[model samples]
Target: MKRNEGSFEFVVGLNRYWLKWFGLWPHCDRFSSHRLFVTLLMAISLLIPMTACLFESNDFADHIEILSKLIPIIMVTIKLFILRVKRNYLRLLVEEVARDWKNFGQLELYEKDVMMRYAKLGRLINIICIVFLFLVQLGRLDMRFEQSEEIGYSAYQALWYDLSPGTARFFIILILRSRKPFNITAGKFYIMSMSSFMNILKTSGAYLSVLKAIK
Candidate 1:
């Protein structure tokens, strides 16, 4: 079967396509200095809401709401730093893998089977992560709309600033939604590394068992 590398047409073409258009998908292949700059700018811009939530809100719930939104931006910033520092290593790994694809036949049957299983598991995990991200986004939107409804009334008017047409709240929600912590490349890297580490442990255990049996 053919693979659709760049196609992000999941869930009625809403979540994936939107994320790709906003430069959020294919996190590894899309990294560049300009994209990094834009990401940093947006992340720094989040400080406005962060500060507002910290000093302006006296309620604990408000603090939680704001922090939830800021968490993704914070994560993205951290991921960017990691990617920048490891760019050379990552590039080399990618090149090596591409060049070595023709050598798959050299692997033993068991090793090939393990690799095939890991490949399927990785794809499944990625799909689950994407779906979870979409759901989280929808939940965020629902919470924002609920907050907007509360702010529209006279009782909860004092909780939020009366900025004319209420563009401040809208902008804050927009930033929160747009800056999600769902980088596929980073996530896949983490999952694959963890899986490889576990596999190594399992192999070591099997070897020790065989030695004990021989003894």
Candidate 2:
């Protein structure tokens, strides 16, 4: 539906665009061309690297490397699949949001303005979370050792490894048969996040001066 920029449906329509782009929306038919297009992309982008990594992962770091790079794609693909499976419920929720906007539309202009202000604020917040989500997900597109998802990926990696889904079960069993945590630990800790490392670098001059004094 075409709507004015200020119309409540504008935001809802934008949301629909994203949902459709992610393949969990609008067209849920078994033979939807859009869904087919996205499914092929997911299979090509998600499965191929995962399978390659599973076979090539000879050590924990290798596993972590793949997990860090693939975890976001895995997570996003899973989220879409789950939502796609529950499309009926998702449709109901979207209708509820639109229905609520209909109720607001009946109010006085000032009242509608107040409500739109809050709704737009909420939409802004949603965009922020999406920005962070995208930052986390961006790690998956690269095959290199991206630090963006290392911390969160290990958490999910443990979950994926423990759940032992399909080939991961046998692959992990073979690779981690006798591996210890410290064997893969740098200074007895996983090199999981770069955020704190930035903080450390920010204070390196102070630490350097202290080291010079001690010498």
Candidate 3:
């Protein structure tokens, strides 16, 4: 019994030592930030079902289905945001260290930089998951719009009439997901796509200018 008590005391002491030195207390102030994220994620999840129920018509069923998918998406978005925040914090920490102790050499800086990069990668993964889900929702919207117009209705109608709040929620989910790079290749591709689009616009503008000058 005495030996067991001693072991328990040793464990408790070890925990105290680590908590004090590592600043790893369970109820620490830093946990408040994590808690806020959890709250927001839960709120988004709750909103999914509540918002879906509001759409009573069959036309809005697809919207609700897409909105339902957004619960997982918003949760993933919060995770991505948290990782981005961590990366930014690490960056700020490195900057602050550089300002305070110019002697804080590359080793310490590199360590933080590596951590920031890894956090960013995690954020990117979450973003990819979100984007994949968003694209799926978009495909659904496109199909819905196409079906509406195919049966003899207007095309490219006002979003107010064509898209419901549920659909809006799905679009928001897509935006959240697309806010990061899913992988190195995907990131590169996204950058290339943006560059290509810009180049196309520039060429188009130049062509228009030449035509105007000729006229």
Best by TM-score: 1
* Per-residue lDDT of candidate 3, residues 98-163 (tens digit): 343333233476864664565456556666766686566556555554454343222222253468
For candidate 2, lDDT tens digit of each residue in 1-215?
22333456645655766776666665445545477466758656776868698788799888886786577667766776677678889888877766667676467889878877877887887789877775564333332244433544454456465554785666455445323221222585644334444556678978999999999
In order, candidate lDDTs are: 0.57, 0.62, 0.52
- C-alpha RMSD of each candidate structure in angstroms: 15.7, 14.7, 18.0
Cand. 2 Cα-lDDT: 0.62
Model 1, 165-194: lDDT tens digits are 575677566545545533223355542233
lDDT of 3: 0.52
Better of 1 and 3 by TM-score: 1
Q: In candidate 2, what residue range of length 10 has the lowest lDDT sum?
A: 177-186
Ranked by lDDT, top first: 2, 1, 3
Tell me the lDDT of model 1 at 110. Answer: 88
